[model samples]
Target: MKLLKTAAVFICLTATGCSSLNHEPSSSSPSTRSAASSEKSWWPFGGKKTAPETAAKIDEAATHAWLDAYEPRLREALKDSKFTLERRDNVLIVTAPVDSSFNPDRPGMLMPTTLGPFSRVAKLVEGDSKTGVLVLGHADTSGQAPVNRQLSQERAQAVAAIFRLSGLRRDRLLLKGVGSDMPRAANDSREGRALNRRVEIVLTPQHTLMALLAQYNTPAKAGPVLAVTQTK
Candidate 1:
């Protein structure tokens, strides 16, 4: 049974029988950071993008104003979807599905950024909102730790590429490959391992966004009182 679970996680191939989707990673996002040299390629899904200068140059308070308005609207875009949102404190946990097909290496592994979620992310940046950091993580359990780590990070890059299509400044997003250092579930079990393979999107602090909101909320100071004129 566990073996079947293992096979199931290999949806890219085993998917002949099962549907073209796997719902894992809702458990815990896997994030791993490692350094390795690899050839760089242009994003296939959509062309690279950059945020407007106005969006880029702003304080946290002002950005937050944009965020305050953008967040709710963004939520609406993601409503009733597979991507789950778990917000704690100021961080937003986006457990969005990625299309494993978009992965770079094809023969051995199947990693693609799920299209649905990617589209949603693009919408956020396309709008007139504050810019911030976007960290991408790929979670997988196929190859050994070292290889899987690289794969996970590559998978993350794939998602970031899709976001780049939306036209946000590449600088606003810090693209890295976190090979599966972080696991949401146990790797011992097939189901656990599948759950481990995922992309964890954390909305790290975007001081620009915050500052924008502050200025937006700060009310204008009252003007000084005028001197009374004598009518008599």
Candidate 2:
């Protein structure tokens, strides 16, 4: 009887220990679980993901005002050269005749007189960090297509180089050669061909001004509204 009682006591103690082990609380706290959940949500391949940057908005009114102030100065500076300045919206377009700007003897070399006007333009634009410049070269349809394209590109590059030398930032200048593809006039007559052969310099507002405008001019989102008709 004593041996049986001892055995029964030992079995009861073993059962109680197993029950206590099963009822023990989890080791992780609420804060620890939250940290783990946050990591899982943000991490991809063990690296945290970041949101992309939003682009800046352009202020049309400010841009146009800037161009308006810029046009007369550019026109006065290039009065002596065979260049014409026209303002369109937020952009100032300066058109230079290739015959007058470049030398006939040297393919892509600019004329000495042309240098003064271009330098003056560079001086005017270089001071304004809000503006960007584009130099486009155009050729008449007189030469072979490939040759004309290459000539136009070289001329555009030469103009950009002059701007860079005259204190303009290289990053702000864009150069392109359109060849005979973008003729201002018909290529059938001599006068028309002369008009076709030209270099166009375009200046407009850059990122900083545009971004400032964007912050203030964001359009408000419209919400749905129910309309009720009145019966008389």
Candidate 3:
């Protein structure tokens, strides 16, 4: 009887040990559960992550087409002046000499004559809700860096104010002051320095407008439509 009882106890202990080894615990610690979940969520073979919806692609062809249509109109509006218009990629850049746009005595203030051209530009762009206007002020390297930057900023602001007063949407206008950083000519000569002192009005199409243009310009059989790459 004693032998049998000892045998039975040993059997029970062995069975309990085997059961524990065969089955995991019913519940795990929070950290262990979280780690397992993370491991299951990751996949090494998955492709690159998608870009955000706001990261639209620009249609180059559409942009160029839009520029083609507006370039002549802009040139006509700014005719017979110190202002020169050029097409750089999709942007229409209207470059105006500082002498024509700003008062010599007050570098930050706009010349009275500058109003007509600026107003004309404002009127042209105001009707197009899909265009954005950038007023950029450039200064020669004659003054202190801080002073030049401030003057440039003020001039840009002055130009932007004119656009606003002429009924351009406030949200569509931006201003920047580049003081002697992007010179059009060598700054060592008087003529070169004069050339560098200028303001540029940059006109760019918004992404929504570009997309529409792409669809309109692209042939139906030309594979996928051009994607909008960037917003205004």
Overall lDDT per candidate, in order of appearance: 0.43, 0.58, 0.59
Best by the lDDT measure: 3
Per-residue CA lDDT of candidate 3, range 32-92, in tens?
4223321221111123212123435677788778888888888888887778887765577
lDDT per residue (tens digit) for residues 1-232 in model 1: 6545433344333223111221222332332222221222112123432222332343446434544655676577667666666543334446654433433335223333345555576657645334454444455556765666555555555455545556656445544334444456667887776666666554534544322222211224111101101000
**Candidate 2 residue lDDT tens string, 130-180:** 787767667899997666765775676667665665577644565555567
Model 3: lDDT of residue 182: 61
* Selected candidate, larger lDDT, 1 vs 3: 3
TM-score for candidate 3: 0.65
Scored by TM-score, the top model is: 3
Question: Is candidate 2 or 3 superior in lDDT?
Answer: 3
Predicted structure 2: clash tally: 0
Task: Output the lDDT of residue 77, model 1.
Answer: 65
Where model 2 places Cα greater than 4 Å from the true spot, the runs are 1-57, 208-232
TM-score of each: 0.53, 0.64, 0.65
lDDT of 1: 0.43
Candidate 1 wrong stretches, greater than 4 Å: 1-70, 98-113, 140-142, 208-232
